[model samples]
Target: MAGIDLSLKEMMAIDGALGAAVVDYSSGMALGTLGGSKELDLAVASAGNTEVVRGKMRTIEQLNLKEGIDDILITLTRQYHIIMPLTGRKGGGLFLYLALDRERANLALARHRLKAVEEAIAV
Candidate 1:
């Protein structure tokens, strides 16, 4: 398993990566962040995405679904955003967020690689 820094580093290595962050959805705070440009602020994005996760979770609870969320994908005209909540005990209420440049990204591959990175997270 990898630590937060390592995990963030690995995420930034993915093709078209614009930014990456490990966020606590419960508190809308980022534990760590990497690779964000002036236009893409990882910390601000983390907090914003926290609401997205919470809203989805609330929907799931309202519907009484047993299954949990795997990931959330938001495709913009110029970018792709991925939000992956950690399912492990240690990682509960936390998630990994990644933003990519759509022009350079292969969505399928980015999703696959992000999943791998999520699995390898130690905290």
Candidate 2:
């Protein structure tokens, strides 16, 4: 991993954070999660977003972009969902999923911070 600890705690450190997970996109299963709630299940959200990642990858292949995604942003009325695919040898099928409270979050800062975390994460 990039940091001493490549865990959800690092992600939840961001302002207006909700939940975060290290997920396996191929299987749509969260390897770990933090800040999950009854109203917003991280597992389900992770799975759903896994499909979103797959769709985007498929589209990229069809378009022959021949590049990897930096991040996927979904802006909602109250929330911002960020899906960032991991890179490196073992990073092939992994991603970081972060959910933030839009009103309290600084989107630009969040993206910057997320990128930092992504770089630190090993696999």
Candidate 3:
């Protein structure tokens, strides 16, 4: 296994983590997943989130922004959804998706940890 393959496991260790997945934005596919309850279909969420990443990428291009997206955070009444695109040379067009319980999550720490996880993912 790639040294970075443990990313999903590390993500699950985060406080309040409800679900986590590595996504292929170009294909709308969840490469790997952990923690989502049955009622919370990770497959569907991963597919839907592809659009979110695409929309943001489009917006940045249209604005001619020089900066790439570090992450995108969606705050719901009870959940926090984070979308982070990967930066690895072999991992273009991929992202890390995390769902957290707002009441129990430390958003700043979770973001920090997610960044770390992104750096470690090999593909």
Per-residue lDDT of 5 in model 1: 100
Instruction: Give RMSD to native, each candidate.
Output: 0.7, 1.6, 1.6
Query: Order the candidates by TM-score, highest first — what do you get?
Result: 1, 3, 2
TM-score of each prediction: 0.98, 0.93, 0.94
Cα displacement (angstroms), candidate 2, residue 114, comes to: 0.7
| Residue-by-residue lDDT tens digits, candidate 2, 30-120 | 9888897887799999999999999999999999997999999999989999999987775779999999999889999998998888878
lDDT of 2: 0.89
lDDT of 1 by residue, 11-123 (tens): 99999999999999989999999999899989899999999999999999999999888899999999999999998776779999999999999999999999999898988
Error of 2 at 92 (Å): 2.3
Model 2 has a clash total of 4
Residue 1, model 2: Cα distance from true site in angstroms: 4.1
Clashing pairs in 2: 1-122, 2-120, 2-121, 2-122
Candidate 2 Cα outliers beyond 4 Å, as residue runs? 1-6
**Deviation (Å) of 53 in candidate 1:** 0.2
